[model samples]
Target: MPHTKDELPDVLYSAAQVRALDASLIAAGTAGFELMQRAARATWRALVRQWPTANELSVLVGHGNNAGDGYLVAVLAQRAGWSVRVLAVGDPQRLQGDAASAHAEAVSEQVLIEPWTAQSGLRGIVLDALLGTGLSGDVRDPYVSAIAAINASGLPVAAVDIPSGLCADTGRILGDAVHADLTVTFIGLKVGLFTGDAADVTGELVFNDLQADPQLLNGTAFTARRLCIANLPRLVSRAPASHKGKFGHVLLIGGDRGYGGAILLSAQSALRSGAGMVSLSTRPEHVSPALSRIPEAMVLGTSSANQLMGLLEKVSVLVVGPGLGQAGWGRSLLSTAANAPLPQVWDADALNLLAGGQVDLPKGCVITPHPGEAARLLGVSTADVQSDRPAAAHALSKKYTAVVVLKGAGSLIAHPDGRLALCHQGHPAMATAGLGDVLAGLLGALLAQGMEPFDAACLAVWLHANAGEQQGKLGRGLAASDLIPAIRQLLEEQAPCLK
Candidate 1:
């Protein structure tokens, strides 16, 4: 697992797993109150580091351990001579065990505890310690009003652990959620913090392990591992005397009448990313332009399934669907590829075609789909797919018995064996058209070079996102073609070929 200064644990845990960890800590001779205090002290240190000069604090306390963490943070702030106030949103009388002790500590420290009111003039850095990971339904009552007030304040907020009203299991926002400027999470990272709306809501993420037992963590199950360059499999170093035949061939099947650029981008990406031989089977009208754009690729003008048979036999890997239309020509070509014994990468229109039941997917293939395409594949609405992207990706992989890449904010790659990985390195600029094609081609190139479908998909997503991040720094006007050269540079930088 790769750990950056600003990144959380690569191993993501669900709400239940996190609770079990917390319970295990208590069972391992550490008192629950002591653990709560440690969380508070950690949050306090983060708060002071983030805003050293701010002397005012407004802590929003709910009824759980999350609220206990906030109360202790308020006490720490008050003891340090800072003006700290706690708005107890939940009934303080109901707080039990660690939470009850934390409340007493706050009172003993002379921190002002007040009830949440509509007219409360919330100033200073607000601490959103309201709902946490255990919430299942819509936020009710004064808590809703308090959440609304916090959003309207326009003040920077520091969320303790997970943000309130955001599902820690899925990235779904339950009715309403706090949009924090910085969220400090403890123990293991949660999957919700990196995908869907969580990406937008969780501004700058900071993680604190709280000195938990590494042996205990190693023994537990994780939801997914975060994708990074360190985790990707590299192509084997080629010998100096190696020929073109040694690198394997990739056949790109796509490009309808007016969509030649899509297939051209995929071929270019594959060629640049170290595929030994690249071929394109597209509409007759696209062949000339594709050849003109990338002379390295063996462009074929094929309009029927019969024309694709010869090309299919020569290639080791197939990357289908970039700009494949829903016309009979596209269907014929796809049908032929479906029967090929080679490893395959399916993306864009190919996914759309599969969703429409045009053809069955080849075994040991990879399917990359955005939320809409994912919905089509699962026979559900787009909302259902986005609501639980990890579940959707896993379902797609199992249903097709192939690797599935669910592309969105935090792109997820899932395998049929119940293994999953996520890439949270991309920028918003990567949401442009033809980017998916570039990714498919990159994955195809990896597969041709002898990587398994799951490993290739994970590596391709990380490399593509890293390239997008590099170009994203230059601002807008980033084209899909811009990522190819960037990806080539990144691949060499991360995993140099020692020929």
Candidate 2:
């Protein structure tokens, strides 16, 4: 059956961890074949639920337990009077153990089986049970051709365990991975299913533990926690006599000559997201517009580091680099903010300047970088950062000694000590400009309000993405400012004021 986001398990595991979990279950009395059969049953159930009218199925089977599951699914389809055929990519003669038994069961059930070939015609809904988690390198030969054909086919496809050719550990596409409309993963939710290229390949994800032992499942260690509103760090409510000063002030620095909008968005977002007092330090020319746009913000126009130092004395948190250019004016302001002892959130040009070695990341700060900026910070190509985001995030966190929020499709929040969290919600509309500026401001607001760096980053990310998701439903043209009010409402709902 189709599962809701909240219904899926929170803990994500590596391929090896999942295999160990499987082994633990097998060693504790459940036969490996029995587990395979359960997986097939679960996949069959989910497939039927997703497309009940698609009576005909073309099952692509390979070797290993994933293929065994496919063969059994074919058997179930045949027995249920649905037109079904199994195209074995791996030699049926080479099938071993439980997989061999499963193939024999399909044969005994009179299921049609044929060898996979480039010329082979595919009909009905395709089942991509090829190349399980065991595959480590790039997809080679006939399998690559088959995957290409399956993708070339417009037919709806369901992948077993994980999508073929998609790395179950890193979510990197090995050569080319099968883009499944529905992926039925079992035992544990693989980390790859939610990050990197997983979003491009894994369409509707369905997870079934196959009734794994709760004691064993709970005991299994996870690579990272998937951040959701239900599991997010909670914020305490305010007292009845509380004043604006109780929430703490957030000072946002950056708005060079032509980039006033970036800093304005950040300041407005900080105010809306619960910062007690939000201050904007920008170019002198921007003072009137800044106040006109966000009257609640305390606008301070300063082009020099000395002027910024005075403002720094009164703020609790610093959010730098929204419209911060690498020019002399931006550099001076950033230089002053960098030496401040306050907690900080750095983004955009601040990251660029940090990458250029002009300034060092302050301790107890949160740095938000998209792939491009991350590449600069890490001294690698953007492809390298995208290829393995978790590693990049961890490296950045350790290198800077700050919480790192690697913002992308599956946004990852990494702590300096190695703990990591991934945000699974974000909309295409969030790809607009000024969003990162808004995110930096939100991060600063959370930090000023007394959330830990890592916790603030995680909660801020969830709020930013979820608000984008909410506002994005209106369809396209989602402004960065459009997210602020929605975020304010959602934040209050998540961490209510009267509690």
Candidate 3:
């Protein structure tokens, strides 16, 4: 499994799509106020489950339905005999629709409500209900100060819907966002929660649909699909008569001078990931060590583009990157790969060379770029790419007309046809060198086996992330070579060769 989603849905939506789904539910005879109440109850249940011993609740409310949720949660807290108070950041009188009704209900329950000030104190578990998906621009005014106070309070915080000041579409933090210990979301999962800056602020995510009917959600459009076992690309089972030539051959080219280990890591990963015949083309000096490391692979000491001619003719797929520097050797090799019409996986120095405008990327290519390389390729700052990763991935795919794998905390795979998939499983300890090299090779092997470009990228990303997660449990000091064996085991578990 990519991620252990017990009951969490795979579909991810922009805030607008989720709102449209909510509207459709309302149109199908569910009242808007009733949905608000269900959301409040779900939040209340999650809050209590998160911190049952906390006998006090401090809820921050704004002028929208998010405030309605907070007000109703305050009612639940007060009736349960817990000390509860509402810090009305947005004036309660300005609340409209179901929010106004919730305010009246809180007033009737005698819940202590007061205007928020810089000096206001928050005790017990804090509920961030200041803003939901309605936020578009940066956070303003007293709300910023209120959010800072909540973060500084050092209490267990539960955010209703989403944290205030975080963009629901891009996951970009607007000014500042509440760092909640738990966040209980409603209806559908937002794309913001899985990518961009969401991982830094969203902790312990809990999804509640507010009990919306499945019939009402069938036809709703989604922004992206999360990769999981059910939807991952499947490898066909091997027959008893299967031979070495059954799977396609892969040619991996890299390793200029000082960087020899990166290409070997990739070659070993490709061999382990089931490439029929893995060929390594590297510096003449690396030949002995490469042969010693991975004897199962055919190691070639390639110093110039002429050295790769015969091998390139036989190989069906090429992985052109990883340790390939900006020198003439790397440039010549990458240029030759660019001219080949075969499927290719470009990564590391290959991506850098493409960004340098030296060579045009070939068709049937999958380019794996981290934020920095993506920014260089897109001619934007790294901050701009990270600010909206999904958009950057889409733009890169459209520009190069190749399947793009934007690698980061949450890796995105975007196709030229507008299909987007996301990989949400990864570990901080997996942030080591040569990991991208391994990913490039894994993607190459999948492509060599005849998976579609988008599907191969999605499956490779999921396997690489999950393997890193499995190995990262030992804490730090995780080496890049450690992922190869783990990836091999996971691939077997996911798509067994013997069926």
Give each model a TM-score: 0.98, 0.98, 0.98
- How would you encode candidate 2's per-residue C-alpha lDDT over 296-413 as one tens digit per residue? 9999888688887778889999999999899999888888888999999999999999999999888888999999999999999999998888889999999999899999888999
Candidate 2 ranges with C-alpha deviation above 4 Å = 1-4
lDDT assessment of candidate 2: 0.90
What CA root-mean-square deviation does each model show from the true structure? 1.7, 1.4, 1.4
lDDT, candidate 3, 1-499, per-residue tens: 1223446788899999999999998998889999999999999998888787889999999999999999999999999999999999998889999999999999999999999998889999999999999798899988988999999999988899998988888888988999987889999999888888887888888999988888777788899998887889888888989887978899999999999999999999999999888999999999999999999999999978998888888999999989999999999999999988899999999999999998999987999999999999999999999999899999999999999999997789999999999888888899889899999999999988889899899999999999998899898999988999999999999989995
Against the correct fold, how does model 2 do in TM-score? 0.98
**What's the TM for model 1?**
0.98
Instruction: Tell me which residue pairs clash in candidate 3.
Output: none
lDDT per residue, candidate 1, 59-92, as tens digits? 9989888889999999889888888889989888
Predicted candidate 3, C-alpha RMSD: 1.4
lDDT of candidates 1 onward, in order: 0.88, 0.90, 0.91
Report the candidate with higher lDDT, 1 versus 2.
Answer: 2
Please state the error at residue 258 of candidate 3 in Å: 1.4
lDDT score for residue 263 of model 3: 94
At residue 385, give the lDDT of candidate 2: 93
User: For each predicted model, how many residue pairs clash, with residues at least 3 apart or on different chains?
Assistant: 0, 0, 0
Cα miss at 477, model 2 (Å)? 1.4
